[model samples]
Target: MPHADTLTVVHHDDTKTRYTDVRYQLIRDGIRIWSREGEHSLTDILMTHAYRRREQKH
Candidate 1:
């Protein structure tokens, strides 16, 4: 999971139709775990923890 200190930037197109992209940067002890583009959901964020665990095994 992203630390509470994580910084996230959400960008939208001029049309305001939908979220065009999202940028996430981890600002604490660990490397950035997930920085995805395009639309996303709460589930996606939650799933990042699983991904992080997988990454740590490498």
Candidate 2:
């Protein structure tokens, strides 16, 4: 499983058609692992962390 230290880039557009790119750095053991870039929803990011945590628990 990947650690939260991974950074994920999420691109999105507002109702006005303005593009917004958000970069999220995953924190695990006080370090960063990897990164990704793409258009993602807030729910997607949250679910990613949730899934990572669950995986780590096993």
Candidate 3:
């Protein structure tokens, strides 16, 4: 597992359409490990993380 402090999440949005282009990022040791774009529901957050983690293993 990554360090506790390394698993940080940041929402990067530069416009009023943050909801439209919801870019949520997962960072580890100052590097972006996973991210997703576009409007997404709160429930999708968990699914997105799991999907990215699985993809990273490959």
lDDT of 1 by residue, 1-58 (tens): 4332234332232221122223334443322333345323332231121112133555
Tell me which residue pairs clash in candidate 1: none
Highest lDDT, which number? Answer: 2
Off by over 4 Å in 3: 14-58
**Which ranking of candidates, highest TM-score first?**
2, 1, 3
* Per-residue lDDT of candidate 3, residues 2-52 (tens digit): 322222233234211112222344433233232244323332122222212
Task: Name the regions of candidate 1 deviating beyond 4 angstroms.
Answer: 4-6, 14-58
Model 2 scores worst on lDDT over the 10 consecutive residues at: 11-20
Q: Which pairs of residues collide in candidate 3?
A: none
TM-scores of the models, in the order given: 0.16, 0.17, 0.15
Ranking by lDDT: 2, 1, 3
Q: Which lDDT tens digits does candidate 2 get at residues 1-58?
A: 3433333333232212122233344454222223355533333222232122343554
lDDT of each: 0.30, 0.32, 0.28
In each prediction, how many residue pairs overlap at the backbone (N, C-alpha, C within less than 3 A)? Answer: 0, 2, 0
